[model samples]
Structures are given as C-alpha cells and as structure tokens.
Target: MLLTAVAPAVWGTTYYVTTEYLPPDRPLLAGVLRALPAGLLLVALTRRRPHGVWWWRSLLLGTLNIGAFFALLFIAAYRLPGGVAATVGAVQPLLVAGLSAGLLGDRLTARTVLTGLTGVLGVGLLVVQPGARLDGLGIAAAAGSAVVMATGVVLSKRWPAPAPLLAVTGWQLVAGGTVLLPVALLVEGPPPSSLSAGNVLGYAYLTLIGAAVAYTLWFRGIRELPPTNVTFLTLLSPTVATIVGWLALGQDLGPLQVVGGVLILGSLVFAQLRRRPSPAPVRAAGGPAAVQDLNA
Candidate 1:
C-alpha cells in the first residue's frame, strides 16, 4: 500500500518533467526514452527474457499500459491545457471500477461506486474552470488514455506474470518502447540536436525513478492488492501534482481547486474504508448476533 501510494506521487512529477525538460514537440521521444532504456537496463540486470506466451502477454500489457497510454497522454497534453487533460485522465478510477468487475469478477460495491463518483466530481471542481474552452481532440486523447490504462490494469491482474516484478516491468517497458520507436521516428523525427543538464537530469529522473522504480512498486502492489484499491490511490496524483506545480513551478491553485482536493481526499479515504475487511464475526454465549436474536 505504501508502494502504491508512493508510485503515483512520483508519477505526478511527469507533467512537469515533460513540459520543462523534454522538448515540447517530441512527445513520442519522451515516451520512448521513458520506457525503452530503463526497461532494457532492467532486463540486462535480470537476464530473464520472455518467451512464447509471456512474450505475447508482455506485448499486450505493454501496449495497453505504456504504449497506448503514453501516446494518448502526450497527445492530450500537447493539444489541451494541463487542467483539462488531467480531469479527463481522472476518470481512470471509474473506468478501472467497471473493468475490474467485468474482468476480475470483483464485486462492484455501492460504496466504491459512490466514492469514485465523488472523486470524479472533485476532479471536475479542481480542473474545470468557468468559461474555459474545450478541445475535442484533447478530450478524446485523455479519455482514450484512461481507457487504455484501465484495460492494462485489468489485463495485468488477469494474466499473472512469472517473472519478478522489476523484470516484468522492464519487459513491458521494452516492448512499449520498441513499438513507439518507429512511430516516433516516422511521425516526430529525431530528438532535438542539443540538450541541457536539466534536460538530461529530468529525463533520467523519469526513466529511473518514474519508469523503473515506480513501476516495479506499482506492479508489485497491484499484484498483491485489489484493482479498485490500487486505482483509488491515483486520486493522490493530481493533488501532489498541483502542490508540486505551485511550489516548484510557481503555478497558482485557486479556491475551487483546494476544495476539490479535499473532496478527492475524502472520497479516497471513504473508498478505502469500504474495501477494508470487516472484523471476524464474534460468537456469543447463545449464538451469533442474528442467530441469537432469532432464538431469543
């Protein structure tokens, strides 16, 4: 659970990293760099490559998780204002709730549904400004990214991996990066000719901490915990991002966003409460509470 919470906190840095460090025009390159090299390094360290069924699984999971998710995320960020893109992405928990029920046979508790809805409402409050114009393409991109990420989350749970968490994450990154490399080349061309220290450090942070470290923790936690529980943790990302934005980048947070942050946090706590296991039933001298009452 700590890992689950921390992973998204790290991920919250991505919005800043992409905008500040990486070239604005090369979103694909950013995605590729984030996934591929870190993945290969993990693979090399583990010396455990996927074969046969695992290869297909890695490809599918990687595409949905990293490739499609990152591509759409980059596109949305490029096309839309950050707030709008973030709000669209905030729909992820809702998507995960629905998909987990269908794919994992997890019960869709009413409390969970309500909490998730509240979280969405909070996100709306936080990001949707009055009289702000909408970009159709950007909305689609962010929404699509959420769906792809939801699919990946469900599939990853459905298909258990044999490799260690870090190794599996690495393979998925490699596969995602490989798929993106050609698309990036054809569509976005090569990266910028010159780079700066800040650029290198930002990219390194993204690759090592964001992709490698965070993902290993994420997958491990997902494998151990329920999908809804894991998804609920994402509520923290926007809040963290907003804080980081304000503190690091001097972005301002309005009253509405602050209220929204409270709502999101409340909803997350509520959802977690719903998912927590109840204490074991206690037996009385006569019988169980309902049973004893019936007898009495």
Candidate 2:
C-alpha cells in the first residue's frame, strides 16, 4: 500500500510541472509522450507481448484508463478551473465502490459509503473555491473521466492479467499511447518545433516517473488489493497536488484546506481498517469434529 500510494503522490506533481515546463495547450502531446515512451521502454526491457485475449483487453483498458481518461481530463482542464476539475473528479472512489459492489460482488457497507462521501467532501473543501463557474460540457467530461477511471479500476481487478506485472502495464500504456497519437496529431497538430530544456526535463519526469514507475505500482496494487481499497488511495493525488502547489509554487494553504486534508487522510485510513473475523473453535486434529471439518 505504501508503494501504491506513491503513484498518486507522484501524479500530484503533474500540474506544477506542466505549467512550469511543458509546452502550452498540448495536453494530448503530453499524454502521448508520457505513456508511449515509458511503455515502449518497459516492453523492450521485459520483451513480453500480449497473448490471444489480452491484445483487446489491453486496448480496452488502455482506452478507458489512459486514452479516454486523458482526453476527457484535457477537456475538463480547459473548460473548468483546476479546483472544480479536482472536486468533480473526486467522485472516483464512490463510483469504484459502486462498480465493485455490482461487478465484483463486494459488500456495499455504510462505512464504505460514508468514507467515499467524506472523501468527496474533503476534496471539495481542499480545492473547490467559491464562485467557480460551471460548464455543462466540462462537468460532463470530468464526471466521465471519473466513471471510466472507476470502471477501469474495477475491470482491472476483475481481469487478472496472465503476463507479468510490468509487461501488462507496458501493454496498456503502449495501447493508450497508440490511441492518443492520431487524435493528438489531428486535433492539436504536430508537436512543437522547439522544446526548451525545461520542456524536455518535464516530459522526461512525467514519462519515466509518472507513467512508468507510478503505473507499475498502481497495477501491482490492483492485483494485490481490493479495488475499492485501491481507489480510496486516489484521494491522495489532489491533496498532494495542493501541498505541492503551496510549498513549491507559493499557493495559499488556508485552514479549510488543512481540515480537508485531515478528512481525506481519515477516510483513507478508515477504508483500510477491516474488522477481524472471530476465530473458529479450536478442535483436535484427529477428533470426530476434525474429521467432519475435513469432510465438509
């Protein structure tokens, strides 16, 4: 879990890096670069490709988790302020809980529901500001991103990969990057003619750290942990982003933000705590009851 938590924490740096170093208004290009290079490098390193079913599965998961998610996120970022986008996207955990309950047959407990709601509230307090304008399309995009991401999380848990962890991660990234490449070329035109040192460094950071390292840990978590449990950790992304902004960029960190951070952390902890089941009655190994237990 600690390793998994690092993914979102790394992601939190994206906003600052993008603003400070990346080319302006090139989200698709950024997405492509972040996903493809890391993916190709992983694939080359692992030298593993998807078998019969996984090609489609990789494509679908890639589209849902990375390609479509990035496109919608781009729209939301363009139309909505950062706070509004973050607040809207905070519904991811709740959505994941619901999907897990329906698809994975996980229990829909009150604690889980409340924790998810509290997470949204916390994120709202942490980021959403007063007088934030709403665009219907942008709101839709944000909500869609949450839904697709939630579905991706649940589906990934549902479909355990046959390939090694890094190989599977690489396949998804490659597929996602492939999906984005044409769209980026058509929509945003070609890449910028000249990239500064900051641009190269920023892209390198995002590709190597954000996509490659972060996503490997994330998928490993999904393979090992419950879907809802993993989703709760996602709340950390925005919280970390806010802190990065405050410390690195000198953004405001008001009292409300502090409370919000506390709430987010509380929810994360609450979700991870599970009630221990009562122990089975002790019995002799060679007794009739033990024979009955073995028979049953």
Candidate 3:
C-alpha cells in the first residue's frame, strides 16, 4: 500500500519534468526516451521474454496505456489551455470505475460511483481557472487519452500477464516505445542539435524512475487492488502537480484548487471506508456432496 501510494505522487512530477527538463519541440522524443531504455534495462535484468498471446496482449496494453495515451495527452497539453486539459484528464477515475464494473465484473457500489464523481468534480473545481479558453480539439484529445488509459487499466486487470510484475511492465514499455519511436522521428523530427545537462538529467529521471519504476509499481497495485481504488490514487497526482508547478515553476494555485484538493482527498477516504466486506458462506441443506462441491 505504501508503495502504491507513493507511485502516483512520484508521477505528479511528469508535467514539471516535461516542461522544465525536456526540449520543448520533441514530445514524442520525450515519450520514447521515457519508455525504450528503461524497458530494455528491465528486460535485460529479468532475462525474460514473452510469446504468443502474451505478446499480443502486451502490445495492446502498451499502445493504449502508453503510446496512444501519451501521444494524445502531449498534443492536448500543447494545444489546449492547461486547466482545460487537466479537467479532461481528471475525468479518468469515473471512467475507470464504470469500465471496471462492466469489464472486470467488479461490484459497483453507489458509494464508489459517487466518490469517483466527487473526485472528478473536485479536480475540475481545483484546476479550471478564469480566462482559460477551452480548445475543443484539445479537450477531445485529453478526454480521449483518459478513455484510452481507462480501457487499458480495465483490460490489464481482466487479462493479466502470467509473469512477474516487472517482466510484464518491461514488455509493455518495450512495445509502447517501439510504437512511439517512428512517430517521434517522423512527426517531431530528429531531436534538437544540442541537449542541455538539465534536459539529460530530467530525461533520465523520467525514464528510469518515472516511467519504469512508477509504472511497475502502479500495475502491481492495480492487479492486487480494485480498479476504482487504484485509480483514486490519481487524485494525488494533480495535487502534487499543482504544488510542484507552484514551487518549482512559479505557477499559482488559487483557492478553487485547494478546495478541490480537499474534496478529492475526502472522496478517496470515503471510498475506502465504503469498501464492502466479503459475503459470508452459506450452509448446504441438501447433503455433504453439495457441501463438498461448494467448498471446492
């Protein structure tokens, strides 16, 4: 739980890392760097390779979770106002809750639904500021990214890989990075002629610690916990991002953001409290055969 809790907090650094450390014109390059090398390193350490259905599954999961999602998210950030983009991303927890119920057959308690809604509303209240123009295309892209990510999360829980968590994450990163490399080269062009030391350090941190470590921990948490519960952790990301932006980048957090943060955290706690207990076992009335079968 501690690891799970810490992972998203670490992930909150993504916006700052991208804006501050990475070259501005190469979002795809940033994605590639974040994924490929870290993936290869994990694969080398594990010395494990996936085949057949696992290969296809990993590719699909990677495309949705990383490649397509990252592409759309970066585009949205570039084209849309930050607050609008963030509001679109903030809808993910609700999407995850709904998808988990349909796809994973998880019980969708009213409390869970309400909590997810509250989290979304809180994030919206926190991030949307006056004078921010909503770009329709960017909003669509951001919302699309959230939907794609939510699908990946649900599918991951439904069809988990038959390997250690790190190995699975490694393969997904490899697949995602491979998918992104060509796009990066074609669309963004070769990275700028010169690289800054700060950029290198930031890229390295995002690749090794952010993408590799954070994702491995996140997927492990998702497999072990309820999808809704896992997604609730995302609330932490925006809050952390807001703080990092303010302190590190001199971005301001208005009163609305603070209130929104409170609501999101409160919703998470409420959802945790509303967790349903396991159903009690029923006694068999017919015979011992029934009892044995039931036990089996």
Candidate 4:
C-alpha cells in the first residue's frame, strides 16, 4: 500500500512542475516524454513482452490510464488552476467505487460509501475555491480524465495481465506513448526547440519517478490491495500537491485547506482499516477483493 501510494504522491508534483519548470504550451509533449521514454527504457530492460490478447488490452489500458488521461489532464490543468483541477480529479474514488461494484462485484459497503463522500468533501475543502470560474472544455476534460481512469482501474482489475508485471507495465506505457505521438504533434505541434535545465530535470523526474517507478508500484498494489482502497489513495495526490505548493511555491495554506487536508488523510486511513492483505497467488480472475493492478 505504501508503494502504490507513492504513485499519486509523485503525481502531486505534476501541477507544480508543469507550471514552474516545464516548457510552456506543450502538455502533450510532456505526456509523451513522461510515458514513452520510461516505457521504451523498461521495454529495453525487460526481456519479456506481451503475448496473444495482451497487445490490445495493453493498448486500451494505456490509452485510458496514460494517453487520454494525460492529454485531458493537461487540458484541464491548462484551463483551470491546479487546486480546482485536483479537486475535480478527486472524484475518482467515487467513480471507482461505483465501477468496482458493477465490474468487480465488490460490495458497496457503508464504510466505502461514507468514506468516499467524506473524502470528496475533504478535497473540496482543500482545493476548490469559491466563485471559481469554470471552462466548458476544461470541465469536460477533467471529468473525462477521471472517468477514463476510473474505468481503466476497474478493467485492469477485471483482466489481470498474462505477462510479467513490469513487462505488462512497459507495454502499456509504450502503447500509450505511441497513441499520443501523432496527437501531440498535430494538436500541439512538436516538442519545444528550447528547454531549460529545470524543464529537463522536471521531465526526467516525471519520466523516471512518476511514470516508471510510481506505476510499477501502482500495479503491484493493485495486485494486492482492494480496488476502493487503491482509489482512496488518490486523495493523497492533491493533498501532497497542496502541501508542496505551500512550501515550494509559497502558496498560502488557508485554515480551510488545513482542515480539508486532515479530513482527507483521515478518510484515507479509515478506508484502509478493513483492508486485509491477500496471501493467495496471482491469477487471471479478480474475485471480490481480487488483487488487480495499475491505475491513473
């Protein structure tokens, strides 16, 4: 769980890095750099590759988790403030809870529903500002990104990969990057001709820590933790982002933000109280609480 939690915690840095360090007007390029290089590097390192049904599955998961999610995430980030954007994305747990009940047949326990609602409420306190102007396209992208990823989380649990974990992870990264290559070029044009040292360093951090390292842990946890439990961990991302912004960028931490952060943390801890780790061997099927892997 600690390992999987690292994925979103690392993701929390996205808002700051995108705004402060990355080259301007190139979110698609950033997404490509974040996914493809790490993926190809993993592909190069791993001797194993996808087989039979995995090609399409990897593509679909990759598109949902990284390609479309990343593209839309950037759009929302570009359109909305990070606080507003992260608050919007915080709905993933609720979406995941519903999807899990439908797809994974996990019971919608009272604990799950209550905590999910409280968690979103906490996030609203932490991030959403009053009278925040909304953009039509941005709202659609943010909500779409959440839905795509929420669906991907459920589907990944439903279909456990046949390939080795890292290999399966690499395949999705490669597939996601491949799909985004043309879209980035056509929609946003090529990678910027000039990149600052901070930009390069930020990209490197995202590619390695955020994508490769973080995603491996995410899938590993999915193979171990319950679906809603894993989704709940996403709440940490915004909290972490908010804290980081407060410290690094000197963003103000209003009283409400503090209360909200505590509430979110409490909700996350409460959700995990019932998570008993599974000792069974990995298998193709996801029984209720079946260990599955990978997420946005």
Candidate 5:
C-alpha cells in the first residue's frame, strides 16, 4: 500500500510541472506525449502483444482509464476551477465502494460510506475556494471522469490479465495513446514546432515517471490491494498537489487547508482499517482450488 501510494503522490507534481514547464494551452498534446512514448517503451521492453479478448479489452480499458479520463479531466481543468473539478472527482471513492458491493460482492458498510463522504468533504475544504465559478459542462466532465475511472478500476479487477503486469499496462497505454492521437491532432493541431529544454524535460518526466512508473505501480496495487482501498488513494493526489503548491509555488497554506489535509489523511487510514472477508473456496475439475479475492 505504501508503494501504491507513491503513484498518486508523484502525480501531484503534474500540476506544478505543467504550469511551470509545459507549453501553455496544449493539454491534449501533453497527454499524447506522456502516454504514447512510455507505452511504446514498455511494449518494447516486454515484447508482448495482446492475445484473444485482450485486444478489444485493452482498447476498452484504455479508453476508460486513460484516453477518455484524460480528455474529460483536461476539459474540466479548462472549464471549471481546479478546486471544483477536484471536489467533484472526489466522489470516485464512493462510486468505487458501491461498485465493489454490486460487482465484486464486497460488503458496503455505513463506515465505508461515511468515510467516503468524509473524503469528499475534506477535499472540498482543501481546494474549493470562495466564489469559485462553476460551468455545467465542466461539472459533467468531472463527474464523467469519476465514473469512468471508477468503472475502469473495477473492471481491471474483474478481468485479470493473462499477460505479465508490464505487458498488460503497456497494452492499455498503447491503446489509450492510439485513441488520443487522433483527437489531439484534430483538436489541438500538430505538436508545437519547437520545444525548449524545460518543455522537453517536463514531457519526459510525465512520460517516464508519471505514466510509466506510476501506472505500473498503480496497476500492481489494484492486483494486490482492495479496489476501494486503491480508489481512496486517489485523494492523496490533490492533497499532495496542494502541498506542492504551498511549498514550491508559494501558495497559501491556510488553517482550513491544514484541517482539510488532516481529514484526508485520517479518512485514508480509516478506510484501510475495514475488515475484509476471507476468500471463498472453489473446486476445479477434480481438486479443490481457492478462489482468491484479489481485492482482499
């Protein structure tokens, strides 16, 4: 779990990197460069291709987890205040908890629901500033991002990969990058004719560290940890982002923000304390085989 926590924590740096180093108003291009090269690198290293249903499954998962999620998130960032979009996206843990109950047969307790709500409230306090304007389209996009990402998390657990972890992650990245390539070209036009050393470095950080390493760790966490648990870790992203801003960008670190950060941390610990049920026994052919709950 500590290792899994690293993924979102590193993701927090993206905001700082984008604002300070990346070119202005070119989110799609950033997404493409971030996803595609890292994906191809992984594929090259693993030297594995999708087999059977994975070709289509990879595309669907890629769309949900990466392509669509990134697009919608970028739209929200453009249209809504970052605070509002993040607060709205906080509903992801709740969505994941409910989905786990329905699809994964995990028990949904009052504590879990309350904890999820606490996370949302904490994020709202931490980020939502006074008089932050709202755009309906941005709210929709943020909500959609939450839904799609939650579904992707559940579906990833529902469908275990036959291939190795890097291979599976590579496939999703490639598929997502492929989907993003055209949208980026059509909407954003070609990449910038020239990039500075800083721009190059920022893109490289996003690709190698942000997507490649972080996602590998994230997918490993999904395979090893509870889905609800994994989803809750996302709250850390904003928390870390806020801290980075305060420390690095000289943003204000008010009392309320401190309180909000505390709440987020407390909620994360509380959620992790939930008691997981034991895996059920399964009989295969002649012998008994245990059907392990991967989420457990």
Candidate 6:
C-alpha cells in the first residue's frame, strides 16, 4: 500500500501541471497524451499480450479506471473550482469501502467506516474554498468518476491479474487509451497541429511518470493489498498537492488545512487499528482430516 501511495501522490501534480503547461480547452487531448502514448510504450516494451478472458477484462477495467474516469475527472476539473473538484473526488474511500463490503464480501468494520467518513471531512476542510459554486454537470462528473474508479479498484482486487503487473497494467492502459482515442478525436479534434517545447515536456512527464511508472506500481499494489485499504491511500493526493503548492507555488496552508491534515493522517492510522491477524486452525489428535478442513 505504501508503494501504491506513490501513484496518487504523483497524480497530485496533475492539476498543477495541466494548468501550468498543457494547452487549454484540450482535456480529452490531455487524456490521450497522458494515457495512450505511455500505454503503447508499455505494451511495446513488454510485448506480453493478454490471452483468454483478460482481453475483455482489460477493456472493462481500463474504461472504468482510465478512459471514463479521466474524461469525467477532466470535465469536473475544468468546470468546477479546483478545490470543489478535489473535494468531490474525496468521496472515493467511502465508495470503495461500501463496494468492498457488499460486492467483494470484505468486512467493513466500524473503525473503517468512521475513518472513511473522516477522510471525506478532512479533505473537504483541506481543499474546499469559501465560495466554490457547484455546477450540475461538474458535480455529476465528479461523483461518477469516484464511483467508476472505486468500482474499478474493487473489481481489480476481486479478479486477480493472470499476467505480471507490467503486462496487466499495459493491457489495461492500451484498452483504456483505445477507448479514449475516438472520444479525444471527436471532442478535442486531431492532436494539436503544433507542439511547443513546453507542451512536449509536459506530455513526456505525464506519459512516463504519471501513467507508466505510477500505474505499474498502482496495479501491483491493488493485486496485493485489500481493496478498501488500498483505496484509503488516495486520500494523500490532496495532501501531496497542498504540499506541492506550498513548496513550489508559494501557497500557504490555513488553520483548517492543518487540522484537516491531522484528521486525514489520524484516520489513516485509525482505520487499521486493532486489525489482528486470524490464527491458524489447531488440529486435535482425535479429529479426522475432514474436521480439520472445516476449521481451516
């Protein structure tokens, strides 16, 4: 889960990067640049293709995790204030926890439920601005993005990847990029006729760091960690973004942001508290092998 945190933390830079260097009115194009090229690079490098059910599974997961989610997220980001957009996404933990409990049969302890709520509250405090107005479309897109991403993560955990992490990530990336390709062309038109050096650099950073490296680690973590626990790590994105702002953009944190940080950290610890491992079954000398199996 610690390694998985790197992905969201890397993603924390997206808003800043998009605003700073990427071309305006090109959200779908940005998604293409961020997902397609990097995915193709990964596929080319691995040359390990998915066989069997993975072909369709990759498409579904990619649509949820990358194609639809990125499109909706970009819409929300452009339509709403940054803080409001981020706050909207902060709903993911609760969604993940609920989906894990209902669909995956993963236990939802009270601590986890409360901590998930705390994460939402904490993120709201840290990011929501005073006068953030809610756009209907932005809200819908933001909420839909959360639901799609949470569902994707839970499904990814439920269905273990048959291939190695790189191959799995690459497959999904390609599937997702392919899904987004038509949308990008339809909405944003053909790729920009001209590319500035800054645009090239921004695209490269997003392709290499944001998509390839971050997603590889992300899928690996999802393959190993419990779905709900893994989703909790995403709460760190806004925190990382805030820290980046403070360090790079000279933005300062307020009192609420400080308190919000504490609550977010505290809830992260709070959720995992009292998670004792279940002990192995002990076999009695008189017990039959079948009886031992039941206990196991």
> Local distance difference test, per candidate?
0.86, 0.93, 0.86, 0.87, 0.93, 0.86
Cα-based lDDT at residue 43, candidate 3: 91
Better of 4 and 6 by TM-score: 6
Please rank every candidate by TM-score, starting with the best.
2, 5, 1, 6, 3, 4
Model 2 superposed RMSD (Cα): 4.0
For 68-123, candidate 1 gives per-residue lDDT tens digits of 88888888888887777888888888899899989889887777778888888888
lDDT of 5 by residue, 147-221 (tens): 999999999999999899999999889888889889999888988999999999999999999999999999999
TM-score leader: 2
Screening candidate 4 with a backbone cut-off below 3 angstroms (N, C-alpha, C), the clashing residue pairs are: 219-294, 222-292, 223-292
Clashing pairs in 6: none
lDDT of 1 at 227: 84
Residue-wise C-alpha lDDT for candidate 3, range 186-259, written one tens digit per residue: 89888888889999999999899988899999899888987778878877887788889889888877788888
Number of the predicted model whose lDDT against the real structure is largest: 2
Location of the lowest summed lDDT over 10 successive residues in candidate 5? 286-295
- Models, CA RMSD each: 3.2, 4.0, 5.1, 9.6, 7.5, 4.9
Ranking 1 against 5 by TM-score, winner: 5
* lDDT (Cα) of model 1: 0.86
Instruction: Report the C-alpha lDDT of model 4 over 174-224, residue by residue, as the tens digit.
Output: 999988889999988867778889999999988998899988888877878
Regions of model 4 farther than 4 Å from truth = 275-296
What lDDT is reached at residue 2 by model 5? 95
Poorest 10 consecutive residues by lDDT, candidate 3: 268-277
